[model samples]
Target: MGTNRWKKYKIEMLPIKEPTEIEELSLENLVDQILNAKKLDPNADTTALEREIDQMVYQLYELTPEEIKIIEG
Candidate 1:
């Protein structure tokens, strides 16, 4: 019963594949790519991503939430 419980609790590990192509870009380039892709894509996910980006940008730029709300309004 103990052995059976141990077997049942054992985790199966799967092989993980590393990505073949990974390109590292500057933060500016990354932001540009994200914004451009968001502009091109008209999906709900894209809009949500854009909103997240906007919040990050505002925080990084030291803009207040009130300022953002004003601009957004």
Candidate 2:
């Protein structure tokens, strides 16, 4: 039998969010989703998720072009 290294932690499959649903997520919810994604698969590619988070932040802050340029840099 394999060692139960994660015995104390409960593991369950997270629901996959559709693109439209993801687009409507609040910033706090989006952050939670990102954290859960990382918890589920640290090595998995999260570029798309990160991109969505960036988009949400940009919208929330309503940053100007100069601010965005500075932040992007």
Candidate 3:
């Protein structure tokens, strides 16, 4: 029998840890936290999250740039 080029592999993944506490937070608050935290961590995806929030707010409230800036700031 010829040696197999591809070997069978078993991959073990680590279990994910859940947050210690679940707090009731609004989406806006969550996004704001993400944005602020991203300033410290380069890997955080705050920009994409912010864009999603922007789209959501536009659909729901039709917020202007000034209004959005005021909220975000």
Candidate 4:
């Protein structure tokens, strides 16, 4: 949260890219980039995408509806 390294990062953000390219990175790196993007752009919105991702993760793990509520809660 305190570092500025992400600000100087030159890679194109996946969401904003055209003819998208896959950049394999760890979850930590992905989260860092997301947080950094938020920091750099406070008005940036990704709520729908977040929910989509959550649903995908839940489906991937075959989590139950009850489990989803518990986990999301």
Candidate 5:
């Protein structure tokens, strides 16, 4: 019988910890974060998470750039 190549290595698994609280961000903040991310990586491909967030935000509020600024102020 052939010896196992990885028999000497010991693997340790860490316990997963639950979050203390669920932090919620306003639509404005989410939009700002998404815009900043896009600006930072304009050539990057669009992600499913980003698309989902965009859809959620769009459904909740259909505000223009001007309106977003007004709300932020």
Candidate 6:
């Protein structure tokens, strides 16, 4: 079973402009934004960002949710 260890991980909210800036951008710009996301907010919501990245990957590879679950697990 999962423990409370996950709760110890720090999380922070992102500035609205940063997410808006990253949306609908070119691939190159997207990469740049990802690298600079934390720079925009050191305590940003990284878990959400990570999930966003997973969603991106799933879309890029055209993988189903089940496939992603297997891969993640």
Best by lDDT: 2
For 1-73, candidate 2 gives per-residue lDDT tens digits of 7875554334435433444455565655767877888899988677887887787767656778788889989
Indicate the residue-level lDDT of 8 in model 3.
40
Better model by TM-score: candidate 3 vs candidate 5: 3
Clashes of 2: 0
lDDT of 1 by residue, 1-73 (tens): 3554445335445333332232223334556767688688845255555676566566556678789998789
**Which lDDT tens digits does candidate 4 get at residues 1-73?**
6865654356445334222133223334555766777899977786755665566566656789999999978
lDDT of 6 by residue, 1-73 (tens): 8775434334334222233334446445555666688789877665765667667656666789899999999
Which one is best on TM-score? 2
- lDDT, candidate 5, 13-65, per-residue tens: 43333322321254455567677778999765547546656555543566677
Candidate 2 vs 5: which has more TM-score:
2
Please give the lDDT score for candidate 3.
0.61
Off by over 4 Å in 2: 1-25
Indicate whether candidate 1 or candidate 6 has the larger TM-score.
6
**What is the lDDT for 29 in model 1?**
55
Q: After TM-score superposition, what is the CA distance of residue 56 in candidate 1 from its true location, in Å?
A: 0.9
| Cα deviation of 62, candidate 3, in Å | 4.5
Lowest-lDDT window of 10 residues in candidate 5? 15-24
- Identify the runs in model 1 with alpha carbons over 4 angstroms from their true place: 1-45
* Cα-lDDT of candidate 6: 0.62
Clashing pairs for model 5 are none
lDDT tens digits by residue: candidate 3, 1-73: 8985553442234333332233224455777788688788968767766776566655456568888788778
